[model samples]
Target chain A: MEKTGADGFDGFVTARWSALFHLARLLCGGDRHRAEDLLQEALVKLWFAWPKVADEAPEAYVRKIMGRAAARSARRRWWGERPVDRLPELAQTGDMSAAVAERSRLETALAQLTPRQRAAVVLRYYQDLSEKQVAAVLGVPVGTARSHASRGVARLRQILADVIDPVG
Target chain B: MDHFEQELARMMRDSQEYIPFASEQRERLREGVRARRRLRAATVAGGSVLLVAGLTAGLFLLPKGPAVDRPQGPLTRPGTSSSSSPAPSTSSPAVSPTQSHAPGTPTGTGTTGGSSPPSTFPSGSVDPTTFPPNPPATTATAPATSTVAQGTRTARPPVSSPPAGSHSSG
Candidate 1:
């Protein structure tokens, strides 16, 4: 029914702000600045689409917008081509706890993955979504999404081998 | 769940506190919506101006009708005098044969219906027998008076009383 004006939108934003913001952060691999930019862009898009949204759940529509924004930003950043080498192994040694070392390694490794791979990993493991759900979020086939997750996990394991599993 | 997946989920949960939606976040969203509206308006304005300019240019650039059809020379009104003569020549008994059949002259008497009279006289043989005794004074004074005055000058007035058959017509 013709939801006019920005009042309903403002209320929706206030109600779902935390969840959407967290989703944006996850999609952008915890880059707070990029995540905020992505969220703002998505909100602007939603503002334009607010009238035509009809009876669909606003959160799902906005979540889809956020995912698309993340993908487009990735394309723009990489010039539509994924980088050949996202993470180059660095040779360094330090004495730290396994948890801190693994966390730091994950953050650095996450930043190095292509946008789609990072998004797939975040949606699958971090957000606890099934492969099908992950594929829907990333707009890829289930097989492609599984490949992205496997490849992303393999890269992270390789990069953090010294910290996550020093013996093996 | 694999040990690596468990660790990843735990780390993501820990990082959840990093990005909270506060007043500043809402402000940024409001600003974003405003900027988006402004951009849409500017795009519409630009498109409208381009459309108007295109139509105006198209109107001016189209080819006009052929140039050959336009009327040339001065237009004559219905009641104005013609040939520079103040009055009509009703009293002259002897009409020059060439004047009656001049190629471009009009045959009617209306002010505007007739074509313009010939400005220059035709150079041809003159007939001495057709000279009228009382030629209109205004006719001789017309701008093309040279030919008429010359034609009259060559005619000897003494031949006015010549015998009807004695006049040799050229």
Candidate 2:
């Protein structure tokens, strides 16, 4: 229950090291360079906390820590508004282009979502967590998790609307 | 889930990329942990040395009260001359001046050699309040003296991690 020092930190590193890297990748928007830096910083924080929380799941706690860390490092907005991302046109409609467009769409859509909403989506979809599990992991109510996921998904659809239904 | 919902879920799955966590990254993390532990260990060791020195010094160096005013002590039999009990313990006080600085000034008597510089008061100087009749010295609160001495976190937490290949987090 009580983590003393090195033992707790080593246990934490063994448990969630991989998951933390993935989280950094997502939070850093596919920028593996920045993701690595962010993850190292996050791990350093976990090291600082290892003594007190050695027995707990390091991944879950670290995920919450990453949330706070990313928020702190987030690009500031102009009056609480992030400019909408301009979608790359679907030229030629080839599978390669379509895939690229879709990836961009997903990334841009995620960029549009609030940090919390993006986190909810990543935890739900990428981590394959159930709503309840996401809620518990994020330390939020299940309803709140569901709402973030729903709204995030809705916005993604809206962003893709023009690309898919060219006539509409 | 509706078709679109299912597709959206699949879309996130499709976007997922493998992140190869190199051995180097893990080493970096482990090293960071080791460094922090070392730092904490150094802090405790340093503090402990200071505490022992202070207690020893306070036992001997600072303004000790009248022999009759000697407070309770585990080191002494009750009602014995307090003078004999503390003087022996204080033999090692110089080893930890920082640790014993406050305890020396029990009740703010502020007579710690550390606090009052001999250079500040010329050899022949005497305060007007103390005139020809040197006033009887006052004692400080025992509780206050001890509190100042023990300011760091006293609670020690348990930390156990079995050797590698001995236990698993799974």
Candidate 3:
């Protein structure tokens, strides 16, 4: 019985590792090292809780844990001290340069958001979760989730407006 | 999804292109789980040792406080029949040392003052009709001293006899 359970847990870990790591990277604001640590911590917790989690959607369970862990790590560390990635110069007007500039501008703006706001935005837009679903994952009220997502997107648009398009 | 939302999804996909998720991380995660379990087991063992030590210390320290301080046996010990009486005074064990000693010292002085008979006498008036039904000062203070000093002293006359047992035992 125990061996089968272990095998199941191992299989789940192997299958979900990449997708969860990708989520973790976005949640960690594209910091590969921090994302690796965050995903590893989430996986460790998932392994220990396999018995309880086996009955539920393991991906959602791990995502919720990762979201909370990322939030907690953000609180403890001075991530705000790290400067934003430099935005491309406004005068470089080539088509290819413009798209790369917009992407970098969007990333820099996303990195500026508070961890909760960023997580809510990523889960709501990137993962295609409803405000209610985002709330469940973030352990917040639906209204709070909606507000975080709206405010995060508004901030991102404001920051990236010149790079993406001058129009709203 | 709105245009901004679609852009966010695209941006996230673009950002995560470089992070390589490896199979070895599963073993790393399992190692972490084992370390956590060991830490939790150590914590439980340490806490249990501390609790057992605390209880053992409490057991030894408790008896050293003087056996007399234990709540007096039963209200039955007083041989008093009034059931309602014990309620107010049952709290007397803790109150005994301070309350009893305060009144006891003055009575001791009064007894030695050659006014022993006046102090010793329970009711000063010969007419029982005029006397209050309860002479609580003597009754209450008497048991308090007796119970409080039981380990070190003998019982004494209830009225105004000085608690020589308390003084001598001290």
Top candidate (lDDT): 3
lDDT of each: 0.61, 0.56, 0.64
Q: Pick by TM-score: which candidate is best?
A: 3
Q: Could you estimate the TM-score for every candidate?
A: 0.55, 0.46, 0.62
Clashing residue pairs, backbone N/CA/C < 3 A, model 2:
A3-A51, A4-B159, B53-B96, B54-B99, B54-B100, B56-B93, B57-B93, B106-B140, B107-B140
Model 2 C-alpha lDDT versus the unseen true structure:
0.56
- TM-score rank, highest first? 3, 1, 2
Candidate 2's DockQ is 0.16
DockQ per candidate: 0.36, 0.16, 0.27
* Per-residue C-alpha lDDT of model 1 across residues A37-95, encoded as one tens digit per residue: 88788778887788777346677677767765675566574333334454545335377
Off by over 4 Å in 1: A1-5, A75-105, A128-133, A140-142, A162-168, B18-20, B62-170
Question: Against the true structure, candidate 3 has what lDDT?
Answer: 0.64
Candidate ordering by lDDT (highest first):
3, 1, 2
Least accurate 10 contiguous residues by lDDT in model 2 chain B: B152-161
Which residue segments of model 2 deviate by more than 4 Å? A1-20, A42-58, A71-81, A88-101, A162-168, B34-170
Clashes per candidate (backbone, < 3 Å) = 0, 9, 0
Q: What are the per-residue Cα lDDT tens digits for candidate 2 across B1-170? A: 55556666676666655555568887876687688779889999999999999999898956655665877665633323333333223222333323333333221221222122223322222121222221212113354433332221100001111223245553
Give a tens-digit lDDT track for model 2, residues A1-168: 434466566555655556667566665554566667777877887767665555676666677777655544546442143646675353553556555566556666666667767777777777778999878766788999899878876776787565444331
Per-residue CA lDDT of candidate 3, range A1-168, in tens? 789878888888777777788788768766667878888888787777888888788899889998877655566754653535554344454655645554555555767777888899888877888899999899889999899889888877777665445325
Q: How much is B94 displaced in model 2, in angstroms?
A: 68
Least accurate 10 contiguous residues by lDDT in model 1 chain A: A77-86
